[model samples]
Each structure stands twice: as C-alpha cells, then as structure tokens.
Target: MFEPEKMKSKGLKLERMANRLSNAIEKANHNYEIEFEAANKYL
Candidate 1:
C-alpha cells in the first residue's frame, strides 16, 4: 500500500515537469515567430 502511494506521487511530479517544459517551448516558439516577422518587414 505504501509503495503504490509513493509511485503515484512520483508520476504526478513527472507530469507537472512535462507540462512546464512544453509551456516553455511554446512561449519560445511564439517569440521567435514575432521576431522573424518584424525582421522581414525591415528587409
């Protein structure tokens, strides 16, 4: 019983970390797109 509870807690921690990493990647992509468009206008 104690073992299952510990496993569940570890799973939740991994899920949260994956979510944070994806969010950061998405924000970085958005910023890059904005910069690329602005650079094109100046060219």
Candidate 2:
C-alpha cells in the first residue's frame, strides 16, 4: 500500500536532484572554458 505522502516526498527528492545536476553542469561548463582560456596564455 503506497501512500500519497511518500510519493510526494519522492517527487520532491527527484526535483532536488535535478536542480543539483543542472547546477553542476553549468559550473563545469563555466570553469572549463575559463580554465582553458587561461591555460592558453601559457602555451
């Protein structure tokens, strides 16, 4: 017997996970471009 409250909690957790993933990708993209550009000056 599944309950509605449990389902809502699971949905909330999934939403948080999605948000974290989005933030991580944005951060990686920003850092990668910045770092590469900076490194190019030395090479």
Candidate 3:
C-alpha cells in the first residue's frame, strides 16, 4: 500500500536536504578561496 502524497513529500524532503548540503559546500569553498587569497597576499 503506497501513499502517493506521502511519497511525494518524502521526495521533496530529500531534495531540500540535498540542496542545503550543496549550498553549505559552496559556502565553504567560497570561504576557503577567500582565505587562500588572503594568505597568498602575505607571501
């Protein structure tokens, strides 16, 4: 017995979680790039 609405919501939840993870990764990379540039300026 599969519930269509329940399945749909589950998919949406997974998608939202994945999107959050992706955004976090992007932010981390951006911060790292900024730090690297700052460090390079010291050399």
Candidate 4:
C-alpha cells in the first residue's frame, strides 16, 4: 500500500537535501575562486 502523503513528503525531503548540497558546493567554489584571485596578486 502506497501513501500519497508519504510519497510527497519524501520527495520534498530529497529535494531539500539536494538543494543544500548544491548550495554548499557553490559556496566552496566561490571561496576557492576568491582565494585563487588573491594568491594571483602576489605572483
């Protein structure tokens, strides 16, 4: 027996997790870019 409400909640939970992972990756990449640019100034 499948419950529609449970399915919807599970989908939403997965979506939220995916979004958080992507945001974290973007923040890490942004920080890396900033550090790289700053290091370039010394070279």
Summarize candidate 3's per-residue lDDT along 1-42 as a digit string, tens digits: 999999999999999999999999999888843346667767
Compose the digit string of candidate 1's lDDT tens values, residues 2-41: 6998999999999999999999999988884334665876
> lDDT, candidate 1, residue 27?
92
Cα-based lDDT for every prediction: 0.87, 0.89, 0.89, 0.89
Q: Which stretches of model 3 miss by more than 4 angstroms?
A: 33-43
Candidate 1 off by > 4 Å: 33-43
Model 4 per-residue lDDT tens digits across residues 1-43: 9999999999999999999999999998888433466677779
- TM match of model 1 to true structure: 0.68
- TM-score of predicted model 4? 0.70
**Superior by lDDT: candidate 1 or candidate 3:** 3
Model 1: worst 10 consecutive residues (lDDT sum): 32-41
Model 3's C-alpha root-mean-square deviation from the true structure amounts to 4.6
Could you tell me which 10 consecutive residues in candidate 3 have the lowest summed lDDT?
Answer: 32-41
* Pairs that collide, model 2: none
TM-score for every candidate vs. truth? Answer: 0.68, 0.66, 0.71, 0.70
Winner of 2 and 4 under TM-score: 4
